[model samples]
Target: MSTFGDFFKVTTYGESHCRSVGCIVDGVPPGMELTEEDIQPQMTRRRPGQSALTTPRNEMDTVEIQSGTEFGITLGTPIAMVVRNKDQRPKDYGNSTMDMYPRPSHADWTYLEKYGVKASSGGGRSSARETIGRVAASAIAEKYLKLSHGIEIVAWTSSVGGIHMFPPTATHPTPSTNPAFLSLIDTITREKVDEFVPVRCPDQAASDRMAEEIAAFRDKSDSIGGTVTCVIRNVPSGLGEPCFDKIEAMLAHAMLSIPASKGFEIGSGFGGCEVPGSIHNDPFILAPEVPPLETGATRNGIPRPRLTTKTNNSGGIQGGITNGAHIYFKVGFKPPATIGQAQNTATYDGDASGTLEAKGRHDPCVVPRAVPIVEAMAALVVVDALMAQQSRQVSRSMLPPLKTNKPEIKAMVEDGP
Candidate 1:
């Protein structure tokens, strides 16, 4: 249950306030070029103290590739990665009565109720720190997906509560409020997303507003929630398994697993629910052949999506499978539960009511930090689905004639010797 992905599986280890945290990623293809550098950027993105909007707890978060790689290439075995905790301060809880009373809206109560005994960090096991392993592992998956299928996954802050870069509208999506990233979906890059540091919104004017709002929350010792939009480009069609293992379903599973995530939506999502079927349906059109590598455009026998929609209202997925369009989705993250604000709450025994002030560094808004994490999760889901389809496709194509199905057996029966 702790692990994710059937094929590109990652089992994360360690806990919050622990010596270190990391993961063991399995199912990576052999001979792929990989190194610690490939994994560090995502960890750095997910790490705290990168900007004023995030938590102040600064850990270098440097990863060490312990095993499963050799000569700058993956061994196709389990890849082990670890990052040590240098700034951990469990003693920060000494001033507060966290041990006596469960922080309101925190996991302290539910975890105790479920497991009977919980870790010292209470909800630390479910902390955003846990996702460090996921991001690291996904870096590997991303490398493979990019090389094999030219798949590119990028995510950014689409909205901070009501401050949306692209506000939905009735007709034509008014540009006044809707900062239409839709137009730039095909070209948006991680470099552009990171350009607006702390907010990561991509749009300059909109990003400034989002940053200001976060600053307001930070100054007031409060927090806010927001949504992150992600798009996956160049995924080959026929990657998903129907009836259960749909691409969107797997994407939902990966996104919802992130800490503080409240809701998940894909491609048109809730907005499509408002429009009529005639307007909402994505009409299919012939897709121009796409090359496996962008620099050198040449066919590689990977099935090109024969048809594409004029408008991606379906978000690159239809009927629970990928249709070779850019798959887009959004994840909504709730405000950080551990705030500096004082509140009146009951003790662990529920016998007495008292005030509790939470401690530790926490993000005022998680969406800014969650951008790369969303991308990481998307990569994991895509890589896993791709592997599944590859296994099925290769096995079926390379099958040997079975004794029962062989034509020679049919000929013998006809001869009646």
Candidate 2:
């Protein structure tokens, strides 16, 4: 279950308190330039102790490439990467209340029920530490996507607790209906998102408020939950499998797989249900001219679609496939369950009953650190879908063109950028 993807397979290893945690990334295109440096930035961003808002676990999170590359060039084999687990404190959860009673809402109980044994420290594989492999694998996928298709995946904290960067109103009940929100998605970058560290909200005022909210909860030994909004620009159309593996469906599967992720929704998402069909429908228009590909880069050569949607109420995907429009979505993470607050609960034996004050270093609000994780997962979904679509296109290209009398069908077949 630690593995993900088909063409680009990734199998993660290790645990929260284990010796090391990493992944084996397969399906990287050979001869591509790669190194540990290409993957470290994201690891550092997702590492703990970046700011007071995050956990105090001072992990350097230095990554090392064990194999799959020869002098910074991928050898067309599985890439093995690892990051040692330093500063782990297994004693923090030993010979204490955690031995009997599981932390309320934490994975402590369910993991024991599932495996009949639990890790000595933390949630083991269920911890956010598990996402390190995902981030690492996705870094490679992101690099390939950027170099090949000019794809850009960026995510930022959009809401913390009740404070929203773009609050819904009577006139603009959802971000899809708000021009300002659309503009932000069109131009926001990871650099701009990181400018407001600790909160990562793009808006200065909203970021400040969110930091304060998190501090208030941390002061009281409590925690808060929020949402991260991510946008993927320049993704080619025709990505995603129909019927079963719809683009949105695969995206939901990927997003929800991350630890603490409780909800996933694409553009207009639940809000679209409130609008009537006339207003919700995305009208088609001829796509404008696209700029030339970047000079001297390995290009995928996937042509841009001839048509695009006037309104993106469908979130860049219609009928389960990408429409060559910017694909955007939001992921909701639940509050970290490892709060310091004491709670009454039954023990493992279901007999002892008492307050168990959990002890551990945890984030007051995870949305800040969760930004890269969301983007990483989004990149994985896009890359996997792109590979699948590309394979199908290549296989079909070998056959003769369909000889049809219908002008409409012929026009559709010949349409291209």
Candidate 3:
């Protein structure tokens, strides 16, 4: 189903070349302040035609709030938002017969097999443009999460094609913003769009190489793909459900739903599989000074030194639940199949076919633009989990206070001054 979430359900509709694409977000709390402006920035980030690296199709992508808000405040009804497709190139798509001949490595063949039909122009529902509604709804979710909890999500293109970035370490520096969308061109002089025009790598030398590679491929009419890494921090524990609704499972479901995403791994993903169990396990450590027992702490005031496997072979997920650690994951994207180069294929009539060359603007690499999309999707998953957790513990009286009686603390105290 296109809809997701247990408590905070969201249903998205529309297509890439349709009149508009939008989403209806249900289960939002009443009285939360929301506006079109809040979502515009994220939409703009995902909008094509922003730079030379992306499709030249320019879209205003302006959001229209159709319902669920009164005077800029949510009324506890479903929130409806739409983004009009201002710059559509229906004519640019050429002939329908050509469309009937599926593009190589795309969902064209599979979609037709399952549905008996598909959008003639563009990939239709499979297009990246379909993500506009998701980004918009996610913007609202992010705002809510920020207001309620201090959680943050970020993603960056860690590698592209043959170039790879060194992992961040304690000794090495960390970027203020994730490197995913940051300008890749590193030079003493300020760069205009052209200067930062290659693959989005900050390292000047590597960026130069990447740019050369992209230019070479573009000239030859080919495409490439890479990887994106996302990090979610400050997420409170106990936000995920056990059994079917586990946090990682929910996140995997959402992330895999993105178009062109081929793989998903959290924490010490595939790499962990190579390590022995003894080397991969995280060892828990007890806190030296637990908060004063009177300060309303759990019996184990010092949380167990979590399943601190020395190395993160399991990717920070244990028993399908979050264990109060930073969650990290990577997604692998396949090369864009809409390359300009010609490929051999059969025509619709099954006649002896010739080569077909793709015509139209497309990214030589899509990993850069995917960074924001990944972050937006991650935010949606985390916020939904947070809301679900909050819903289950509806009674404040059920939780112990932050402070307790002095006598109770003394009674539980161990031998020591």
Clashing pairs counted in every model: 0, 0, 16
Name the lDDT value of residue 69 in candidate 3. Answer: 94
lDDT on C-alpha atoms for all candidate structures: 0.84, 0.89, 0.70
Model 2 TM-score?
0.94
Q: Single out the weakest 10-residue window by summed lDDT for candidate 2.
A: 293-302
lDDT of 3 by residue, 1-417 (tens): 778766677888887678899999998888999999888977877778766666778888999999999999989899999988888876656675466477777776778888988877778788888888888888888888778766666666666677666444333223212243222211111122224433544456666666666666667778778777776765666667789877888788888888888888776566555556665577765434433332133344442232233333444567877655567788888777889877898765565465667666677777777877887888888888877766665554365543435768646643221
* Candidate 3 all-Cα RMSD: 6.5
Using TM-score, give the best candidate's number: 2
Q: Against the true structure, candidate 2 has what lDDT?
A: 0.89
Which candidate, 1 or 3, has the higher lDDT? 1
lDDT of 2 by residue, 1-417 (tens): 989998899899888888899999999889999999999999999999999999999998899999999999999999999999999988888866789888889888889889999897988999999899999999999999999899999999999999999887777677898899889989999999989997999899999999999999999999999999999999988798999899999999999999999999898977767778898888998777755532221213344436788889888998899988999999999999989888888888886657899887899889999999999999999999998987887787677756545776755554322
Ranked by TM-score, top first: 2, 1, 3
TM per model? 0.90, 0.94, 0.81
Question: By how many angstroms RMSD does model 1 differ from the true structure?
Answer: 5.8
Instruction: Name the better of 2 and 3 by TM-score.
Output: 2
